[model samples]
Target: MPPLDSVLAGFADAFTLFNLLFVVAGVAMGQLVGAIPGIGPVMAMAIAIPFTFTLDTLPAVSFLVGIMKGGLFGGAIPAVLINTPGTPDAAATTFDGHPLAAKGKPLKATKMALYSSVTGDAFSDMVLILASAPIAVIALKLGPVEVCALMIFAFAVIAGLVGDSLIKGLIAALLGLLLATVQLDPEQATPRFDFGYFQLYDGVNLVAVAVGMLAVAEIVRRMAEHDGRPQPAAVPQSEEPGARGVSWREYWGCRWTMLRGALIGTGLGALPGLGSTAAAFMSYASAKRGDPGGVPFGEGNLRGIAATESANSAVMGANLIPLLGIGIPGSVSAALLISAFVIHGIQPGPLMFRTQPELVYGIFGAMLMANLCNLIVGQLSLRAWSAAVKAPASFIFPAALIFCIAGVYLSSGGLFGVSIMLIAAAVSLTLTAVGIPVIVLLITFFLGRRFETSLSQALTILDGDPRALTAHPVALILLVGALATGVWMARRR
Candidate 1:
């Protein structure tokens, strides 16, 4: 470990007035973009990158980190309010958050998310500060074979947790895998399902797929149900103390759920390619398995919100571990941070610790400070978002639809993305109408490409030799676990 005095000095650097202001501004801006459909923190950070060129390195880096930490909570706002996930990872949040809102406890649901997000982020940041190097070393041992086996376990868990019928859930997951195959084959670099559309050569845009199925579909369904009628104004939560907010007792009650989520997220985030969306769903599935009789997993359960928010938020801090220790970008956000570091002439890796110890500790301090900022900013913004949900249904649905269209168009795919979104929305509605689990399908689709890439790489490495599996104990264990989980779930159902 670095000398105690150096750590203190680094923290002192982060406490400067300029750094604090940058963090605050970043947190506020992050929440703004995160609450809006399609404009997540990744895009916000990308836009803000050029602006940071004039600033000092610590403040500039802190600002971006603050934005990422804050977005974790902000993404849950719309998921809780209107059944629309502001970010793809927040899709899991919608399973129970929107149900709570419909039950007239929007404030309670949002508060649960806020508390869980901060708690998980703080836990992972502490882990990053103390044990990042060791964790990254362990994470490096997980090769393509291990990753493929892990994805199999994830799919098994999710299929069992999502819907009543195991067969239906598996079918939806298969469809998602099929959708992911539309892109050029990872190994061959040849298109399999593009159907001669040049635009599809790059495959379907994730923003379009996610926003369409989660946001546009819900908007269309609600509009059809109401038939243009104005909804009654939501009653003010202040009128009822018992139902308006989460209590300290309630937060304490979910301590185990949050801890499990944080652990799952940190572990997954340390590995490159596996992302927060998968972590969130995995945590949710675990929580559901532990609680067979409580709150039904998807119907206004506070623990559901806690599970997803904690896991996704934890991912942000844990993603930095590999970047700082091994110079490997664990996720897209970490990849962006790599550019920022390189622009400042700082190379990430073990040598940096000896050369730039103060800067490293300062980054750690900034992460801790960002967590506090997220809490304050998130609490302040809840009222504004709550009021939005209170607007008449006539106004809410129309505005949401407009945002969905605009957001998809502004995404990388442009007009083509918008078209894909419309089609995906229709498909989402059809699947829901037929009693299929849309969340399972969505999760599998999000993970399918990575799973395929890993499987192909694993196969190449093993050269079709069954004996080679013995050398990869981790992969063998994971594959066995996947089979066991599948059988366990099937029997339980």
Candidate 2:
């Protein structure tokens, strides 16, 4: 907590005028960038990073966090108006989000997105503040076998979420995991799929691949499908308060789903390495698996928006746990935030608690303010932004592709990144054409390492007893779930 004294001293400078300006500027830039497809927080942060060199640590970090908040919400913009995702994490948002807009409820969808996102984010932050230690304690007990099975469960759940077919989702997920494996073999130092390229020695960068497959690929596909059709102009619209007349009744109507999504996001977010994208996949899967009301998830279901938004939003807060408690960045953005700290000569970890309490708390306080800021700004502009739907996909898409190319290239200063983007986009397009679901692929990609690692650990701990999984409660539960899902699918078939 002692480090916090200096942090508090640092906080005292928030009123110094310059820091306040940076925060506003960062948020504005983030929103603008976020509205463009294929550019999210990562790209926003990269562009903003150069500017940080001109400022002190507190304002610099504050500015970055503010951009992050803006980027998170910006994804909803194009997704609702154009049906293209501004961020990879926002891909799921396109499902129900864009559909609702097409149905003349763009304002409603935007409002729901804001409320659900802020709700999930706020709750997750609270969990990080008050419940992270307890959750981490439980998470530490998980071993290799449990983790592997957990990955399998994640795979099953995600597969179940994508439309009506499990095969499609599983295939998509497996491909994603395979792509994820292209770079590094964690246990054995040998690369399995680098194809003799030194650029791949570090393995394929996830950001580049994600951008290529989701953002750039979408552009090419759009161009092929609709050649230069003029999109409609923006609609003049306004909302009651949220986005439409989003009533308290409506909010409470989906409260259970939102709360569940937040809980799942928080838990998954707390896991080291996995992040908001994974959180969205898993949360959607869980919603599908646990649904009692027979509502379709991918078809403009309000619950779907609530599910994805809440889970992904909560993931941000959950990512902070390992960062604050153990000095480990849970996601790339968190990793970037870590660098900002180190640049300022502030070391993170338990020692940080002793040294910079105010800075840490300042982050917490800023999170609250940032969410409020997002909500207020989101409500004000969500209606006007609906006009983007009027922009022809033909024009908007080329611009979107450019942004995607720029984002992937800027991730690292090399042309190889472009090559990877091409490869990923082609592969993703090929697979999707054959009916594979993206969420399925992403889950497999994320959990591939965790699966392999956990299985090996489980085996090691049990002296190679394959049946040892029966003794672990988590594993057993997963087994039961698999059995139930298999039986259900078979019956439906």
Candidate 3:
């Protein structure tokens, strides 16, 4: 258990009026932005990230974290009605959610989605609170070799989780890795791809890369569709007429699905490599397989919504576990969270537990409060935007792109940012079309340095001593565990 006094102190401080307001504004804005086609919390935060440069750490974190929670819920809106996913994580929701809409019960689907998502998110946050410390302690004992191996393990996991094809995932990973080389070389500080342009010295802006790949490419794809007739179909009830309310009977019945999904999500989130996509898929699979009531998964079942939403929301809390516990990010959202910590001059490695307990616990408290705020605000305002997607994509997408471009400028202050955006978008489009997954590349891109540094350090240690592995008990243990786990997983597959 965490120190009670410290936890209480941090929780109290985080609950102040200002932080509360930040939470509210962030969730609301996050939802609004998420409603726009092709824009998600990751890209939304990428654009907003530059603006937060001037704000204090708490407000900035509060604002960003709110979007993350709200974004999950926001995706449900479009998925339920228009069949478009606001965020990548919501892709699964559309499977059963849109089908539910076609069946003339959009309101019921939305309600079930909100309820299940909140439950899943809340459950995962609880898990995060309970699991982070033990993981952190384990992370502390990890040495260079273990850390490097962990990154490799993460790459494999993401590759397996994303897309239908492993080959595609590997391609995307390679693409991302290639792009990661655009800036200066880590060891020499010498620019490798500058080509005499000062803008290339900083390499590529992550914001530009994320926004371009996620939003711009998506926008282009939408425009290429048949006459842009505006994706359609959901029940009028989904719009939430005053008469509609969640049926008590349905709520009670589907509650078990929520519980199971949340539990699954929490467990996956604690692991370093498995993320939301995995959680959502696993939750839905488990829920379907464990179904005792003989509910059909694809035919607008409340149970389906429960499983998907619960796992999706739970993903946010679970993602943070690895980030806070070990310096590894299980998902893109956690990857961005790392940037937030960097901006605050806080490192997230093993020592972070000792050096920055307050921030760590404060983040936990914030996550807890954010999920509560999401449920409250989501339920309260669910009726307001339940109808058709009101805004045109032309307007929403342009504004999103503009914000992204401006954010890139503010963050990097050069045309290289814009170039990176176009390049990443094109690359992302190509990879997706060809069925390559980007996640494998994201892991390698992010953890490449750690792998390199660790490998070099271990080599140096080995040059002077042959018994280095024996000397470092923690490293030896980690190696054995990694090998065992890998073989077992491979065999199972």
Q: Which prediction has the highest TM-score against the true structure?
A: 3
Clashing pairs in 1: none
CA shift of 435, model 3, Å: 3.3
Whole-model lDDT values for every prediction: 0.78, 0.67, 0.72
Candidate 1 local lDDT, residue 262: 97
Predicted candidate 2 versus true structure: per-residue lDDT over 56-129, tens digit per residue: 77788878877887777777777777787777777788888877766666777778878898899899888876
Listed per candidate, the RMSD to the true structure in angstroms reads: 8.3, 7.8, 3.5
How big is the positional error of residue 217 in model 2, measured in Å on the Cα after superposition? 1.4
Candidate 1, residues 1-493: lDDT per residue as tens digits? 5567877888999988889999999988787667765557775664465456567789989999988887778888888877778788899999999888787788888889999999999998998888865654554567888778867776776677567777787888899888988888777889889988777877776657766776678778867876554434443343456577899898998999999999999988876546799999999999998884768878988899999999999998888886777555566577567546754767665455656778888989899999999998888888875554334567656766776777667654368878988999999999999988776776667567767888889999999897899999988998898788778878888
In model 1, the Cα lDDT at residue 339 comes to 46
Task: Write down the TM-score of every candidate.
Answer: 0.62, 0.62, 0.86
Scored by lDDT, model 3 comes in at: 0.72
Q: Candidate 1, residue 457: CA error in Å?
A: 24
lDDT of 3 by residue, 345-425 (tens): 667766766776666677777777888888788778776655425567666667777877787677666777777778878
List where candidate 3 sits over 4 angstroms from the true fold: 1-5, 91-104, 164-193, 197-203, 231-234, 238-243, 247-249, 272-275, 292-299, 464-493
Q: Say which candidate scores most in lDDT.
A: 1
lDDT score of model 2? 0.67
